[model samples]
Target: MAYKPLAHIPTHLISGILGVGKSSALLALIQQQPPEEVWAVLINEFAPAGMDALLLQDQVPQDAKVTFAEVAGGCACCLANLPFKVALNRLLRQTRPDRVLIEATGLSHTRELKHLLTGPEYAQVLDLQSVMTLVDARQLTQYAQHPLWIGQVQAADCLVANKTDVYQAEDYQNLQAWQMRAGLADKPCYLVSQGRVHLQWLMQPAVQEANKAPTPLFSPIISASSSSAYQAASITSTVRLTLSREQLAASWQTWYQQQQKTWGTHIRVKARLSNMQACYHLQAVGAEYQLDVLPLEKSSPLSSMQRIEVIAVAAKEDIQNALTLWAQELGILDEA
Candidate 1:
């Protein structure tokens, strides 16, 4: 059945694996929401620590009135998805908004998430607008081994190949494979960067139907299960640590040199920290990363100490060691 426009609370489940800019996309959407409306969001994090809630809260206005519910510590597709359901239902009842957005953990499988929304239970409460899958055009090389990542692209109603600015000429071909998987060679798949998409891009194309759920290349039995391959760990401090830009750059480069070697992978690491110069938004994903200084007013609400989150496919001990060492090198004497 074709969904009636705005007949119920329209929901857009933003799906993508790590570093695809799902959070950045949500930030863009949040910035553009009608100033008078209340937007509710449900965020999922593979690592037990959830940073999306804090990150999102920082980007919105002091009085913009965005409500959030977060499910962390595991895959949202596990345990019959109780965590996800609980968060979504609670957010809806609390906010009672006309639209909702769920930013699933980067490792989430789209089929299971889609089923939760389009299922009979939520069919009346949620008007499934579309599933937007954000792909980092540069990361297409490693995606083949991550079956669930591809599964997400296959289930998307619209595909967005983000980070195009950094993509090479040959990378566009990845979209063809993605389109073929969805059996919608003509579907609205676009190339964009910086998580910016036209407002129209968010609306369902009047006639585009949902894609067939993907068949994972993994063992079929567990293919349907959304299992998390990453573990998250965090280190906090009572007060901000002082570090120079050069020091920050050097430490990050050192981590890259060590972690990018064979058998080591860092999915993502995010930190909001203050230096003598200014506050910065720092992030690392795979072999690439970024650090941007936020305007003073924008970063003013943050606490003195940085709250850091590290997501990795490595073992839990390795993740803790990596993060702890990172904090120490950054000049923090105590890791809270």
Candidate 2:
């Protein structure tokens, strides 16, 4: 037997804004993976606790040939950064996967990451494919002037309007109008619900050239010491505080209502919580929120611990204070 080099691994970047279903889309793609082919996923989350990985793990089949790694606490946009390079290199060497999926943090600018993937270092090892940017049709106007959002869209080879099941006719029209206004009307677009993207889309030729000069709307790559436009804080408790389903929702609503003005339009919160009767996953983007019950058997190990991650545009102190208040009201802090 002779040692053989692996073929170029197909790589895809799944980019999106806060709470736009990037994780769900990535999970859907993972579920569609062929059993024989090994796949690797790199997830970047603004929160240090990496709640997305936990939630995603709960849903992924235990027997699937998928490997996941997370770069938490900040965006992994810069290739020179040690964490990004180390995690990616480790995964590539360890798994030797057929494909790789990198999910950028919602607040990340993808231009640099895209450049890294297509750069000389990876040119021979990775086949950089379509850069899929997912958009929530309902928030087109809300993020119209946002630099991070603009950068992600500009770096995309294709666009996906996820969560289409909740969209009204006007939302679709706004998406079309925005695409034209952004000079992206000619780009490949898909409308899907619950991030149900077909596998073929990932194989499309990447039309966005990495060497092209970025538009003014595309913000500069974030630096280590530079102040971010957003603030993120994580709240964790070892004991699960008992509350009725209504009480938990009401508590969040009350806290959000108090901080809504300060948090502005960019607020997002994800949590694994429990009520008196069951455990649930709660996700809130802007003012809307949804809760889905989690199976006890799958969530038991984590059920005793409640974890919440919040991202907002407010000051870090303000974000922390608000979350603390919310936690106190919900009895999460008392146990902590």
Candidate 3:
């Protein structure tokens, strides 16, 4: 089928870990696009704070006009199907945006999310633009080096490497090697820090100008999963807490490191803090020693509590244990 960027409303998937700077890049793009061009934003998270939603609202440049919706509970790729529908349905009803930007949770499986958008249900309503996955420069060094990172990096139409500020002393040669191994073709890899993205590259149309453009390949987890299969493996677990600002800040990095060490790459994490000082933080672990996080924002509805959502690839029993351990650490697993 011939895809037209204008024939259908184009939406982007800004995905990475909790700290890589997806929100930063989104802000940069929104800042560059004329207000009339921006349509709406779909912000998904694993947490409830919705801080990123608010920050993006404030950063949408005075001259820009855009609307936003927030989806939290889990990765929109997995748990938040209804929320996705509710958010998009409402946005579609109220605002007909030229473009839509979906800020996905860090742990979100971009391939899966793309499939959902391209599925028959939403195919007519939305056009799947490029799947943009943000990579933390530091973590990309580690993630792209992992055996399974190819599946993640190669799936992206554009692999944005955020946190360039942290890579000044690092070697890009390693990254080049990793990119080659990931079979990235001529796909663009951008280095951005403090949320600086190349607006021209991002805002350009995502549809193939012609049939000769290479077709992006999706992972089996996404392409092969039937609706029943998706329902069978999907588990939505929530963690709520009432920590003071100090405690919340302390738990952020500490909890991540702890989960990284304990889970050993089987868990995915996302959070939105109420402080509004930080963008949503998220972490995703796949195979052994593969972990990364980046900051992200989109927009969704308001929430009354602070929560985090987790998703993993495991049996129900294993997922239950993992969720329990995670909740135990936060001291709120029993609340629900």
Candidate 4:
């Protein structure tokens, strides 16, 4: 059956940096979906393996009317590209969703993505609602001056201080200090745990032109060339592992420490692993890492395969070679 011309479908852009729990936030929102409404989610990942969708698929309520599409391996900020437009158009036409949620990659430039959504082509199709940017108060001091981080914050209609359950008193203070210093004191800010934000925040009308901060002088991360000073690369693998959860986590932590000595401290790693006993999720950034045991019953067929994604501000070749060597060393990848 033919549907309406895709006009005014409530859409929200969920933006954040690496390891800030964008997928977690989307999962929480999906669980809150109205019983009668259909929701379509479009997720973009910086790495080719694209594990976020797999991680979320089994976690969403089995009864919710939710559909998903993903754009992986590259930033989806460029509307001129066919991959992004095709995925989005196909989703809207096929699902005829009552609401839409877009989760952009952590390295994405939201200003461009927002511009495209409001442009003539999609302006009528999507009722661009709120732009919610999730922030980890703990990273304020480390990434406050980073241009990409600044862009995400400036494009947000509201800021969510996620992972607050683990935050210390000083983390809260840092958030306030950064907000005032960044001239975002007037913007709505909410503190939540495990990426849970009230549904009301998603309904807030987006005022991008009025609230957006001035564009930064440097090139946006999506458009940066190989020669650009802000170099970064994402290396991913999909080989099943033979090690236990504890052994896998320990191996990664050791690898991270070794790489830091050569590549400095800027890095992010995420992996999903499963063995006969249980499934696990691992996330690491800077000098710290966390490994969580997940319910085996919730595992999908895709979850059975091991997946690893490493994103760092180092040479692509260097990162790839290092990961291959590390995996082989751990016997996760066979020597060829």
Candidate with top TM-score is 2
**Which scores greater on TM-score, model 2 or model 3?**
2
Q: Sort by TM-score, best first: what order?
A: 2, 4, 1, 3
Q: Which lDDT values do the candidates have, in the order given? A: 0.73, 0.80, 0.56, 0.78
TM-scores, all candidates, are 0.85, 0.88, 0.60, 0.87
Looking at candidate 3, the ten consecutive residues that score lowest on lDDT are: 226-235
Best by lDDT: 2
RMSD to the hidden true structure, all candidates: 4.9, 3.8, 8.1, 3.8
Per-residue CA lDDT of model 2 for 180-284, tens digit only, reads: 877998788999998899778989756646455434432234322233658899888866667888778787777766777766656888988775567778888
As a whole number from 0 to 100, the lDDT of residue 199 in candidate 2 is: 78
Q: How big is the positional error of residue 180 in model 3, measured in Å on the Cα after superposition? A: 1.3
TM-score result, candidate 1: 0.85
**Candidate 1 lDDT by residue in tens digits, 187-252:** 577788889865457677222335465544322322233234466787766556587777777777
Q: TM-score for model 2?
A: 0.88
For candidate 4, lDDT tens digit of each residue in 12-123? 9999988797888998888788898999999987777677887787577555688889988768863354788889999998999889999998877887788878778888
Which scores greater on lDDT, model 1 or model 3?
1
As a TM-score, model 4 comes out at 0.87
lDDT minimum window of 10 residues, candidate 1: 217-226
